[model samples]
Target chain A: MQTEEEFKDFILNGHLHYIPNVSIDCAIFGYHEQTLKLMLIRHRNMSSWSLPGGHIKRSETLVEAASRNVRMHTGLDNLFLQQFKTFGDPNRIQFNKFDKEKWFEITGLTSWEGNWLMDHTISVGFYAVTDFSETVLQTDISIAECAWFDIGSLPPLEFDHSEMVKEALHTMRLHLYHYPIGLNMLPEKFTLSEIHALYETLLGKKLDVSNFPKKLIALGLLNKLTEKRSIGAHRSPHLYSFDREKYTLALKEGLVLS
Target chain B: MQTEEEFKDFILNGHLHYIPNVSIDCAIFGYHEQTLKLMLIRHRNMSSWSLPGGHIKRSETLVEAASRNVRMHTGLDNLFLQQFKTFGDPNRIQFNKFDKEKWFEITGLTSWEGNWLMDHTISVGFYAVTDFSETVLQTDISIAECAWFDIGSLPPLEFDHSEMVKEALHTMRLHLYHYPIGLNMLPEKFTLSEIHALYETLLGKKLDVSNFPKKLIALGLLNKLTEKRSIGAHRSPHLYSFDREKYTLALKEGLVLS
Candidate 1:
């Protein structure tokens, strides 16, 4: 939404075009140079940060809605996305905390009872991983600011978002064992040490450096290239790249890596 | 619902007490004697089978609604339940196939365009594992029949349920590698071969017999008992049971087994 009229109409009659009582929230993880970060946004008239979210359109699928939300905020597309969980606690959104006065100024309404936007909603959570250095953050009329924060140091978020981030990280780490990652975060041809560092940073732990690369090679997801990058005297390490066919197959039919 | 009046009220005014446009479907897997089965139900006016499902109450969480649906059909509780996926496709439900004449008899309405139950609904898919031998199947006014079908010989299902089953089984098998299973499917005290059979049946594949038990032992999820089961005078094998503390810990914080 861009204009005041659109915002007012959405708050009042969005259910005509979008599904009511159902929304989609995304936990977009950014990785670059062995540093991990998360994307968060602050809505207009809100004091705290929150995950970028919106309701599903009446004509779109769940994943399409999520992808659209992510694309709108990050200016990136085709990221590796996966659904982590669906959260539906009745008390998840405390309505008493809603800023009714500010909303009244925008919506021109004193009471929101029986409104489509005031009902209890269930949100589907999706997680995506992309290279932070490649994204250009964007904001809309409803969002006051959009930025990335270090994973270790994050401000207190609004609603059940803190729990959503925790669950998203846990599920993403578990998925590392089953699915293939690092497609967008790494160069087309990289060294073993580079990929190892990527994995360690995403997992938030140290892996046995010797055993990590070997597992990926054994799974046929990686292929050794004859080329090598020269850094110093007697310090050239062999280069490797993902086998696109095998990597795509492993993604569809999961394979154990650890 | 048990009576005609209650069913009529649910179709006409259920949105007053239940959340509309959100439902829950369960893929209940039953394991007994090296055989795996799935629970399927047929509605009163439908010919095709479907995973047993219902809507969520205003006061209940998502999981609670799923548990209640499972309990109503299986006559059991506290099974190992998990949220596999939430399905929301625009064309997932074929309303043209709906038996409008039969519904008209109960609802006394020729058109259900604005009815709460006739809207596009998104269903949350949950998978559960339990011992089928312990459950006594029951049906309500809406369900005409409920029974267990061997997993390998399931007939065609309705409303994208076959896809739901495929996804559910894929997730359950993937979960087998991370979480502790076989808690309710196996006897309190079982032989290594017994658990081995159970895994094979559920995975629908053969595993190397030698390496399976050792992985469980190394994880500290199993304890060997001194007593042995005497199948023959010359062939007596040791019995083992789950380490409750370690198993519970593993369930909370997942561990790799394969």
Candidate 2:
């Protein structure tokens, strides 16, 4: 935990050194238990949730700022990130008088932070894929909690975060149809059914289970491992891992997973 | 042309009402004579060229500002446009000391306009496809000329405009492979070879000419017209137009042109 003085210094002046009016928001998605989930943080003072995001430093690229935000929230780095869109609706930062007063009361931040938050901000939206179980959640000083929610059911989000999430899902679906993406979301040596489940959740529809493995194998992107795992009262299923060389080639060649 | 005072007013106080620090740049692509081209404007006082772009209005979306910029240069409205990326390097608006002095000399823009121009500007990039022969060139007062240069060869561009163009072309190619394009770049009725040329130029590679038409026809996107286009010493090729209904369906269903 940071001291009050340190927190004030970080929030009030830390961002002052960075580029003003430009920010980055990340939709860091993880897949587990046959469901798609997004990481969100609840503000310490407010009940609404928001995606992990921060201002871009003067020396870094927009994408670098997004990566930094991901690390700050999840304690993970080098995730597979892609820039999907830039949201610059001028009214995005507008707040009603009541809302402004409520924010001041909750945050105990006077004019400086209030004006900084209300600036007409332009945010670049990026989406990242990572293994759900691998990340260590780290809530920032201003966040009450950090958690992952099923994309199908999310809490009321702050600002235009809901719109940003919708756009990220749209971009992910488009990419899934044309690219090999499950590798980033799954653990090593996973069964064929696991990979299929990941795709089904991402596409929001069921794919032919029997044909899914065939299509993926045809792309020559997976290596069937010698080891197998047995379920109770059932025969063993073989484990599989991505053949990095072939997977890289398939990404460039454009694999049609659907 | 407006007087110098009006020009300065338009550049300075005219845009001051809009949101600060955010701008829009467009790569207006057109197809003509079996070549893909991009619209560029030469600054009145500089040798370097740049895309037709403008600052976002306080009331408009980023895309809306891009459309306005396209119309300002081409004298055409409602062109098919797609937002590709946003360029937000902090050093983007930074000009060398010599260039700054030179700009003040040439444009007679003192502190206000100069500061506005040098403000750390973040620009959203959009690409629009239009028929080359249909546009009327309209050069703004600050522009020496507005013209189209073949995508294969372009002049020296200003700031990070060259990087923006490269990104736009990359996005266009990626979109071309997964979507039904070229409708905006071609005339209402066009020969199969003409459409093929457009795709080949955009993709930067020659596709099998015989197989290209078969793929497009297979998608049911082309409506066979009763007319034919003539070529000397060869049989006239049949003309075709996009079947709007089927084309819209294919767009949703994902047409893989590759």
Candidate 3:
């Protein structure tokens, strides 16, 4: 190991040093009011919005950083997060034609001179679908506003973020067919329509309501209840809840839903 | 656009290092005559062996880096490399701490201190299942020796790569029930016994040969020619080639083999 003094000297004089560019961005997804919602943070100064994200520290592992970033952004405790993919394109950021001096001057909160604004960035994209009802997000000024965006109508995003969103949504769709996901999006008990609406939001289309509920219930991921839909004008749909015990057991047993 | 001057100054002052510590190590697999092969390399001047890997460049993506490194080490081209996971345990190098310094020294590489080196290091893991019969691998001194190790009998590996092997194998096993992936390890087309043997090597047990041929022919991933097995006192197993047309179409249409 280089001595601390050597490290400081090395930092001060090294020519064209390399830094691993790693940031943790979460695709915090949830189902709300019959729509699949994704958590987004609007910028304070820049005319852009983003998935909650930040850099990983020297001591933090990738997963740790992701969980921490998500919790800090969403105020959700003990939330489990998994890294889905890492985007590393030499040209991924050509859009950031930020003249360094000017961009730094413009975003005055940062000191570019001392910050070794490394360019070789590899972003690890993580995903977690949780329930909207339990999330108590602590909003930050760095994040001027926070809200959930319906998956069907995502606004244009800055950077390659739009592509990242597309990729995450694609992965979620695949997972839905093969795995018992989106459990965190619903309540302790929900109707078939709620689940179908959630699926529609994610898929950006409607589903055959007649076939979906039977297929899902047959998957054994959901537990049926004696309760009927508590509030509805049409014929009440049956109430159901995720069978966490069986689902968790099946997942641990390596059941690939597909 | 970050100016060349700003990029240079960022490198010189340690305020913006560009080299990435994240590397990609591939656990390439191939199936041969009743055997499974794992591609491995011996580091120059080191008795220990490692998976084919290299530094992720600023302009480079993980897929590019892993494929390039594998090609460089083995003179192999167009191998199917898949990005599966990233390994970043804070202290994964407790026993092999000196290996990193020694490898860099031998390679005559410079550091991108501070933001690059001191900040963090994250490595992504990729996997490739190739048809060894088609790849023409070139070996060099950068890697003193290269060989395909049998999965059942692998020597100890350097760093945390052994764990990476386990994960890759798990992924491969997960694919077996769905599609015939080990075909990538075989020649253009050979006999039914050859295919069965390859599975035995992976499964680590003997299998009944009588029913194997019928099952493979039913998968429609193979085409049987009038050729017969030439070895032993038995009829030659029919030579077959991978149905590339079906494989490509299946993958494109997301028609999972299972």
Q: Quick one: ranking by lDDT, best first?
A: 1, 2, 3
> Which TM-score values does chain B get in all models?
0.97, 0.85, 0.73
Cα lDDT, all candidates: 0.90, 0.77, 0.64
Binned by DockQ into CAPRI classes (incorrect, acceptable, medium, high), candidate 3 is acceptable
In angstroms, the error of model 1 at A85 is: 0.4
The best-first sequence of candidates by DockQ reads: 1, 2, 3
For B1-258, candidate 2 gives per-residue lDDT tens digits of 246666566555654556666778899998876777899988666667888787777778888888888988888887768888888876875455224454555457665443655566788899998888888988867678899888878998888999999989877777776677767777889888888888887778878874566678887888899998888668898999998887777665555565
Q: Could you give the DockQ of candidate 2?
A: 0.51
TM-score per prediction, in order, is 0.97, 0.85, 0.73
Instruction: Output the better candidate (2/3) by DockQ.
Output: 2
- Name the top lDDT candidate: 1
Candidate 2 lDDT for residue A13: 61
Better of 2 and 3 by TM-score: 2
Better of 1 and 2 by lDDT: 1
> What is every candidate's C-alpha DockQ against the true complex, given to 2 decimals?
0.71, 0.51, 0.33
Error of 1 at B43 (Å): 0.7
lDDT by residue (tens digit), candidate 2, A56-123: 87777887888888888888887767788898887885455224454445447766444545566788
